[model samples]
Target: MGEAGFESRFVAASDGLKLHVRVYGQPRAGRLPLVCLAGLSRNAADFDVVARDISATRQVIAPDYRGRGLSDWDPDWQRYALPVELQDVLTVTAALGIERAVFLGTSRGGLLTMAMAAVRPTMLAGAILNDIGPVVEATGLVRIKDYLGKLPAPETMEAAVALLKTIGAGKFPGLAEADWRRQAEGMWTMRDGRLAAAFDPALAKTLEQVDLDAPLPTLWPQFDALAGVPVMVIRGEHSDILSAETVAAMAARRADLDVLDVPGQGHAPLLADARSIGRIAAFADRCDAA
Candidate 1:
């Protein structure tokens, strides 16, 4: 409800936790809505700009998973697994009466999207995987682990922007100061007169338990489930997560898959740019037509 007249909804998860979802626009009879799933440590706010644009044509729902943003944090951080989050997602969507829709997932969100394809294929009409694939590179994961939920509180919002720039500027060379500022605002919330991480710090424990040194399993079977659905992958030009080689392999599996290489971004392409937003909106239209 900040500017575009979107509604903020609190849905009850299976465990009775109130989950927050930012709903933009109204559900139409024929056209499918867009569900935006954010990266690890991110929230519904991350998709605000793109969601607003797409909402003009189709409904957009961006949800903050348990322990993130406005959602209630889980007392047992062990419940922060993908299966648990996926259940929460289904609960939110069912409460909203969404039968099938397009899913736009970034990083860890993309992983969840693949999981959905395996468990509830009918829920996905189309999917946009932003800078992630079945095969996650260990190096990128290590880099993410170094920062996730462990950031120091910035005294000022501007300092938060500066801090992000110092950490991510090298990977996202195309992002300007303004873009960083916007990201900082989305990523942190003011608490006790200090900017705090939008997500619960306990969530980090989920990653800390992972053994990066061990080889990660690929979700090729789950990804292959998307064969019947329209798929588009948005990879950052300099991304370390969704590598070009993986995209090539994906294309080999699904010859019809569409790929967009976002310039000057890394790990995940922020769908905040005009071109990226337009591509996604057009993809939604194409899905509706199909």
Candidate 2:
């Protein structure tokens, strides 16, 4: 165990892939365990800040999808689809003896939460979606597609930080240099004496079918499946993915929804900030009470 008080667990998926699941803290007597899911191309490191804090009162589990982080890369890139990823999440949680959990998903993680609600409703105690919804904006997808697997590998940590700030400073204007630096550290890793993006480059294959000119499929039914549970959405003020229109639609469907808009951020709000995390911690308390 490291200073974060989290243990690294390697769980085997049904397909025989090895997955990394970070387990943090001891379970509180009454608090529901929190399962964190990261975005596309992101890894377990993304949850380092929030889990370190949230795990103080309740257990937190953050899993890296097969192709990201320390997990084994899938031989068939097509297995990177959500169905496979969802199975991996279930497998990891089950291995950890977690029958149910309050899911906190960021970006692609949020999508998996909805899928979980549809296929395994009993496992969902509550949900927190960070800047993602049934209706994903194509513009945001385009932006992500343009950069995935194409980022330049910088020679040093400082160079990596500068690259991130140069590319991301516009959307996440609220983030400080220190914030960008941390992001740099998490987004890349050293391998073969060279710095590279943390995720397998083959992940780009999954986006090859995305049609920029066409509307992507929506998951309103999946979102609706969570109507019985407490739900919270944390959106960036400048987010291009979870639009205001979609949020209004979500609210229309479920009026009890808790929405937090983080100013000066875009697409997804980093739950790393004290204010954002405090709200999430409070939401967890309510989930426990419910």
Candidate 3:
């Protein structure tokens, strides 16, 4: 509810696919920017709480990847992977005329940040990784796949609330029933009186090929790209996505690295909450200071 406006635009990627984006901030003639990137299945609006709280001094840009939110669905759903999304982020930066910007990345967005750091290190000011690490837990990935595209469409708001209660019960704890209901409406869209997932259903296809036994690819090269840049990583104490041991390992290598662990959360900590929000803002302020 700040003075931020949601203006939608499109930036054409090298592959000629148009990626949708939303901007939140006042027009600044000369000022460095701050960008927010959402989780795998989330859209730009996922940053609404964070952006609205910081728009006074930072130009916040949020993008909906090829297969999510208002963006066009890829003809080849396999292109929904991280490699393609990284290219799309570069295209977005080029379109915005931003030389460098601080990244407030959540989940998949955090992985994309590491990829960018490896592929194009010069474009980033710094990065705050929210509940994601180079290594991921197979258990969480498997749990996510179980409901990838199997959730039933809710016919009414009440039905949507009920669906969220049943599905999100274990996922997001410590939230009231009303909070879960609000989150459900935000994640879906109303289509012909039924509440449907806002993202393209084809995105679920990526989960079908996930191999849990194999070790996930190492992203050290990507993390190396952030060598001289300020980096902060936030993890949920109960998160399966980023284990505390891995985070400690990352910190050992980089003495300047900052780490935070949110209690009573798992997989990913909701950044919109006040406790995490303040930490993220402080990280950005440190980036500016440097």
Off by over 4 Å in 2: none
Which residue pairs show collisions in model 3? Answer: 239-267
> In model 2, where is the ten-residue run with the lowest total lDDT?
1-10
Q: What TM-score does model 1 achieve against the real structure?
A: 0.98
TM-score computed on alpha carbons, candidate 3: 0.92
Tens digits of per-residue lDDT, candidate 3, 17-87, equal: 87899888754544457788888888887777777777767788889999788788899999999999988
Residue pairs clashing in model 1 are none
Residue 76 in model 2: lDDT: 88
What would the per-residue lDDT of candidate 1 be over residues 1-290, giving only the tens digit for each residue? 66656899999999899899999999987889999999988998889889988998889999999999999999999998899999999999999999999999998889889889888999999989999988898889899888888788998998999999999899899897778988999889998788899999999999999999899989899899888899999999888888899999999998889889888898778899999999999899999988
Which regions in candidate 3 have their CA more than 4 angstroms from the true location?
1-4, 27-31
Residues 177-214 of candidate 2 have per-residue lDDT tens digits of: 77888789889999999998888899998888777788
Query: Hey, what RMSD does candidate 2 come out at?
Result: 0.9
